[model samples]
Target: MVPAERRTMSPALRRTLVIAILVELAVGGWLLASRVLRVPPALPADMVDDPLLAAEIRALASRADRGGTPEWRTLGEGLLGQGAYAHAESAFARAAALAPQDIDALFGQAFCIDRTGRMAASNPLYRRCLDLPDRTEDGVGRKPFALYAIGRNLLRLDDVQGAEAAFRENASFLPAQFQLAKLLVRDGRLGEAVRIVDDLLRQLPLALELHQLKARILEAAGAPAEAFLARAMEERSAHLVESNFSTDYVRPFTTRLGMPRVLQEVESRLPPVPGDPRRDPAVLEREIQPLEALVAEARVPQRATLAFLRGALAADVDDVAGITAALGIVDAAGDRSASRLELEALVRDRMGDAVTATALRERAAAMAPSPQLHRRLAEESERRGDHAAARHHRARADFHLGKAAYRRNRLEDALREFREAAVHDDRHVATWYRTGEMAYHLGRRTEAVEAFRRVVDLEPDHER
Candidate 1:
């Protein structure tokens, strides 16, 4: 009896041992795969000296031929970091086609779109990826990046509250945090913006961008001394002072390819004021000397963009000859024709050459139609008491803006846009229809009925 019991117990113990071993092996395999999948390849020192290394790396990736694999996704990330956005987009698209469930591919595609200035078009893709199961290896999941992207696009669409909510969902996202601080400053909530900047500085003491941002906030808050000190700190930051390249360019992996151009564009659009510290003449002169040298030395499109920026600075000071000289350089480049034309129109309009300005405007309108430009034209026409033209342009601007908002599913924003269109031109039947539809969905029955009545008044045979 004892021998029989021992035989049965030995079989049972062996089975239990086998099960435990299998479980351990499974866990170990998962851990190894996770680590291997998450680690990015290190960049070689030669990559710094040889800018073409990115192309070589991409060539190697093309030979991998392992669709849906981690290798393709990694290569996509590397290409994106190197600013080959079109190539990176292709790689990500291939990966996504191979593995429809892969969030990384989807995110990469959306990121590339944003880099290419298609932020609004990337929104639906972001929403789809974020709705997937949480496969993000990072502890924050996809919320930080997705919310940041959504918030940025929403801000562009004029959905302020929606943008604020999206940004507030992920404070760890530095871009969104920076935007939030800017919004706070814009809304006169200086204390809140300052607190946010302080918190960010505590986490990233070496962040020169944050320092620059803080400088802007302080200047807005009437602290010129503090603002200047912040700028000094930004300039002295090791990340900037240690670099021969532009601080933004040196941190290529942390910034988008067109960041410098975007920053320059923003600066160019600032209201021309002689002594505005934000556009200080002394600082502009200091900054442009290096940029001018770089433009002469560099052979990239950045040179043309920089030349345009210099022209913009000259325009700020009403230096017509300086502006003409700078613009001539940009015109010679042949890449900024549209932008050059727009700038010429602006200068002519500001200098009170209405005939030339009108001709430029007609040319510009033929090239591109922007809601912002139309709205500006409307405002200018209103100022000149050209009510008919103002009404026409206002109707065009609001109609376009409303349709854009509607496409983004910003119903309330669309409603407001449509209402503005109606205010500008009550006979705009499409605007009245959209207003009624949006109001109905929002459960404002009375407003919906009123809007529908207007639509019927405009077009009696209009179908819902």
Candidate 2:
């Protein structure tokens, strides 16, 4: 008590004085920074003005996981993954400023900026990662990631050899090796591409990407039979994933494993561009063996399904007998099945029976809201000059396409498709809901909230 008796100032006054001194010091530091540094901090100019963006920035900044440079870098990487480009750039820039010697921060900053499509601006930042003395003495750090990204941008800039050199620097990185194989293929180095794909396939036999790349490499190498077979294997894997998860309805994780985009990509990668006769009849016939082999290996119930695919392909190749036999496998007398109707439409379309094809597509559209059936209906309506009907059908097609992308957890693609659907017809509650969901996943808070509000307005009691 005696020791504490002689305070020169009141505790409250002392506390207030201390706070005032801190405020003056902070203001002086700000002024000094403005005068001496002569450069504003690397931050988004509209961050404070954009309420939704500010909320996101604040949420990230206040996260308990945030404590220092490493955590900031990690948070930045996560934001980049979630498509929050501006916020990620800010976080990375701050981390790099705090610890100028941090390779991870430097790389992250470049990578985040690169993701925003500013390839030119990111180049120097990426170079800094490689040139820095902060590079670890032994372990693989962000070097491989940086190199792979550089290779991608270099290719975009038409520097193929430079891209190859960058990719080659990280031989063990799978994406780098994968891209290197593609570059080798583009340059007619088929043998090298084949070896790379073979090694990758050995390591990841079930990877849809590797299988698709292998198919192209084999096709490039004049191994059409091998290409056809590899493509079949990829389809088989895809179907297995679809079969397991299509009924889940909510959990998209397993659906993502199915790789729906792979099938779409296959349409482009495969021989025929639709409405173009680039696919040789002989080549198409050669493809029949792989289809037949898959059918032979499949369960009894799957044979008829494979036969449906066989018929559709046969129609494309002008194989009348093959189409007839495959149809016989279906044996659906007076059938109303959507798959059979769709196959019939393809057959009729190939036979130049436009009237019959349109009729069949309309019938299929009634039973199932598939994009194919709806798109055909849209085309038919447009041809008839029924603009409203055409728009309605087109919206349905986009909605269906969006649903497929959504179920596969391709949020960005799903959001795009849903937005397109809305452009055609914005009345559907489900479309709004899905649009909101995708926006939410991509960290598009404003769009998500707006879409959700639209949903509530469209259907008051719609299940969340």
lDDT (tens digit, per residue) of candidate 2 on 1-464: 55665656788999999999999999999988856864322334443332333455445556513366776765575455445577768778878987988987787788668867898789778877877655564555666666667887888989898999988887987778888888898888989998998897777666677778789988877898888767755632332212111133123212121122223233344554445464555554464555456335333344565466567668766777777777777764334488787777776776778789878888778887789778878988898788888898899999889878765646688789999999998897878887887787688999999999999998988876
Worst lDDT 10-window in candidate 2: 240-249
Q: For every candidate structure, what is the RMSD over all alpha carbons to the true structure, in angstroms? A: 21.1, 25.3
Q: What are the per-residue Cα lDDT tens digits for candidate 1 across 22-70?
A: 9999999998886677433333343332223434564547543433446
Global Cα lDDT for candidate 2: 0.69
Model 1 vs truth, CA RMSD: 21.1
Candidate 1, after superposition: displacement of residue 381 in Å?
2.2
The residue-level lDDT of candidate 1 at 399 comes to: 77
Q: Indicate the residue-level lDDT of 312 in model 1.
A: 69
